[model samples]
Target: MLKIRLKKKCKKLCHAVIAGICISGSLLTTSLLAAELGYPEKEELTFGFIKLTDMAPIAIAYEKGFFEDEGLYVTIEAQANWKVLLDGVIDGRLDGAHMLAGQPIAATIGYGTKAEIITPFSMDLNGNAITVSNEIWAQMKGNIPKQADGKPVHPIKADALKPVVEKYLDAGKPFNMGMVFPVSTHNYELRYWLAAGNIHPGFYAPHKGDTSGKINAQALLSVTPPPQMPATMEAGTIYGYCVGEPWNQQAVFKGIGVPVVTDYEIWKNNPEKVFGITKAFSEKYPNTTIRLTRALIRAAKWLDENDNANRPEAVKILSQSNYVGADREVIANSMTGTFEYEKGDKRAVPDFNVFFRYNATYPYYSDAIWYLTQMRRWGQISEDKPDSWYKDVAAKVYRPDIYMAAAQSLVADKLLLKSDFADLVDEDGYREPQKHFIDNIVYDGTAPNDYINKFKIGLKAGDKL
Candidate 1:
């Protein structure tokens, strides 16, 4: 028996050396988790966006390659507005953009162009509304208040356009309106719906040099850009505006205007737009800023996963011709939920255009302290700070520790699922106090000057301007 075939050929060479040491310890544990997801030290990125539809998670992470599956190769351009996309992400010709949750807290509190800018990600929430002109909705349709089928009932309050802006200031007329910038979240939701209808939508003495927020007035507002907001109110020049999304469904599809109200009825789930950069481009591309925020959190979880059913293929890739060129039925009337208001009144606003359900791409330091308490209740932060300076300028412009280190490296590469980020694992980055405004008040972001002293119409607590 040749010594029993040499002990079965030495037990077949000791089971092929223990199966090659368990496949080299499973490829060195996937090369140390791909060196702890740290390969992109900067990989050909461009990014910038303005043409709206909530810039759909940077155009669905550059049309779904999810920035080449985190190896990154993004480009995405389109920007003729939001101050040339926050001056092309503060002069680097945009390595990041799609901004305006008050353009990185009014460019990190210096008010306009002083940039330290940061926003790890919080793009998409209620898309925005407030259109007007069809002669100010037929003089605000006889002070709106109808329901038992007369129609105009929903959330249409700015207290019914304050007696048609006090009958155009008793016919002396300078009522104007439009807001796309001046540190826009459409200029603080059109100055919080014209100061919740008492109407003095003015101020911003900018310490007396008056950056023309029309010092002590009643609805002057300005700046227009958003695809020339319905051709600047169909050429009469801004009778009303507060944009976002196919320019308020291209002013109810060109009958020229009438959206009336929908920053989710002014505050329910607020926080609109963010993804800015330039805090030295996230400290010189820390793993290319967590691999482009893990390819915009997997393109905002594939644009709010199944419930949106990929939003008619992301409203046919934001109506093509280079993202949000509008008209794919005016961006599916509201990126496929339903919102037409006043041209055959469509309704079911399924969270309007929230690119990812409630954690809506979490960058919540109470949504940057409710946009820095609406930039200190709209004198654009000219004074009264210290609610610990609004939580240290909302933890230095809402980083959320680089959005939970790109959502915990996409839940350790299982490509997301840790209950798809259980409220971003121990999120103390505030929230929970928001009570949905349009005047019901209650904001709390750990008390921003007692929510700017409960705005009975802006500035409080030793008010200035």
Candidate 2:
């Protein structure tokens, strides 16, 4: 009887162990599913950005506690340049970054440092300008029409700078201009404005290793880091440049240059920077991606709400050395709904820097297509592609579906109202053909080939260098 009792006790112990194993398996499955559906696999994230006004989304997200609300611990760091920012995101030193709209698109297409980079959030719209040195400004003043107040009329066009460029050319000097990066929106916008005014901003023949963008050119364009723009112009390296604020405002404050035209005049409310990450990162951390996007969306809204009453505070925050590091007054000059043209000619021009309203944060496919077309026009693409190719590329680079997933999660959590975003259920991720360019060229994302063919100044269908 004792032997039989001991054997029964051993059997009961084995049964308990098996039951525990079964229960643990079920719990593990449930946790994995929960993790896959929507919980940040990694909560602590670092995002990279340049020290410019367009990096506001990343800064605002951290300052407003939006990331913390979404259960994400986020740190924003300033990168030295565009390439460094992209490299940081790719190597995982940064989870993501504030990027040019073209960076992800170009990277995906194997343009530079090939990678499948993607953006779910676009950062802001139209915070760039074409500023010229004080001497150049003096020359341009004679060409510009003066207003009743004895100051130059606002929305100063590239026309005023045309004669100045001509004078430099006639004098056998290189008419130098600065843009932030090769794949930057600033580059294309500056080129567009100059080309529209009948100036050859030059072409890039990357096929021949002439990527300096000075082929058949009237003005020679070069890269100048944004923070160094004012000093560079003062040193007479570049006569004028197109850059984002508050660097342009810095030029005004330092008395080195005067801003002649704003990007708003180049293309009204044009898409600027975007929050970029690798496609692999988004796929690996889907939940984290959505949560991060939601935090950014909230931060963007806070920036433009109430006709920008929050801008002064934002300027102060951004002025800290750890952030943009520009002077508060210099940053506030443009951040507070007023822009200075000449040194003392400050004027109210609201909507100069839009962070959220008008769906600025959404990564629309049309926005991607615009940059792609610019690439093609400038010879970075190197070959002709069909309209469908442009569309497919736009779809790959701009992931509005990912953006909507984040928006929906925010709405479900009651952190945001359903009315706060574009109608995601019906959003086709394309803007109607835009016609507000200074050249008055109509751009339709669906017919990219046709748009390319319409340009008289750029490479057209079946054209090769």
Candidate 3:
């Protein structure tokens, strides 16, 4: 059971409910089963998140006593949007946050807000899907291939959406779409899917004060918060959007849109949100950082354990008004290993919200590099950077050292099996050349420039704004 001793140091300690657990002023738990990793320097911490199901790890960590187990008293807050969440972490108002994968990388490289944000944990994988409004879907559905039973073929690509976009363009109409943030996985994934289908989603040209991302675009894309995506599209503010779970699922339940594609289809097992904190915070509170990472890792394990036997419970926690606040049915639609596309067309997608499995929690340099490559491709980077630049920036932001420190401690403490991380042995912080992308292009993170140059619709090497 990974036994540890709680050292009694209470002079006037009283029980107080924290994330539904009563604790002794957040006492330090000493290791009686393994070597003590040292106590957290700062225990009372507040983390921020957007109300998406991908923020489940932070919620699970607190709800399942994982945070309390590490002697950390944690408060989880739902921010207004991605920008506010990142701002909170930067201004020390938030200890950390469930941030977009590109947020930390963009911050480190001075794309948007300049900061030294770092991530020791990659939260979850492949929870996002692209949804088109009912009007757009009606136009797109006719072009999509169908199965024998008359269901639309799975992994419905942007190719199906291409004709509808072209029709709008032919009529001299602006086909607008929404993504969560400028640097969000949703934005990049939407861009990737649109571009792969020969549709121009457009560029940023951020070097020339053109952050609108619609220079010569076939479909104009803009930032909308995750929770607001469906409503915005319903109002016809956008024709479609790419966003995370419950929200995409919400569109189906509300009968306003149909999710045409999931990011898993665009790029299989793609990296999603990350647990982000300032680089200075990690160095200043080394023990606290590792302990918090450990708690998160364990929470991820529990959530993905037994082929997601814990997801219904997780959906309950996430459905609470303070968390994701979506209905349990909507959250469960994706969280429970199946996703509804066209209404009544739910399909099995077991890897839709992978957490601990496939080494999903480990903060890989390759993952960071992939996000950087997307940024450069979409003109968010505004200029060419060498392969080494990508590698250096990845190393600066994605800290596997902290992740491993926490993971090894869990193994030593007998919480997780060593076999659980077999792929990490002699790891060079990069995955092998991944070929699962829907475009049929292989991405070797070791060579970012080569990958960027392979794209047809966006910026490449030496392609200046």
> Which candidate leads the pack in lDDT?
3
The count of backbone overlaps in candidate 2 is: 0
lDDT agreement of model 2 with the native? 0.83
Q: lDDT per residue, candidate 2, 1-465, as tens digits? A: 000011111112112222221232342122333343456677678888888987887777887777755556666777888898898898999889989888999999988789999999999999999999989988889888888888887667778888999999999999999999999998998888888877888788777877888877897889988998888899999999989999999988888898888988888889999999889999888888888898899888889988898898899988987778899999999988988888888888798999988788899999999999999998888899988898899999999998888787777666678888745568788888888888789888888888888876877877777
User: What is candidate 3's local distance difference test score?
Assistant: 0.88
- By TM-score, rank the candidates, best first: 3, 2, 1
| Residue 286 lDDT (model 1) | 85
Q: Which stretches of candidate 3 lie over 4 Å from their true place?
A: 1-29, 32-35
List the pairs of residues colliding in candidate 1: none
Q: Candidate 3, residue 305: CA error in Å?
A: 0.6
The window of 10 residues in a row where model 3 has the poorest summed lDDT is: 1-10
**Which portions of model 2 miss their true places by more than 4 Å?**
1-37, 422-424
TM-score for each of the candidates: 0.36, 0.91, 0.94
| Model 3 lDDT tens row, 253-357 | 999999989999989999999999999899899989999999999999999999899999999988988888999999999999998999998899999999989
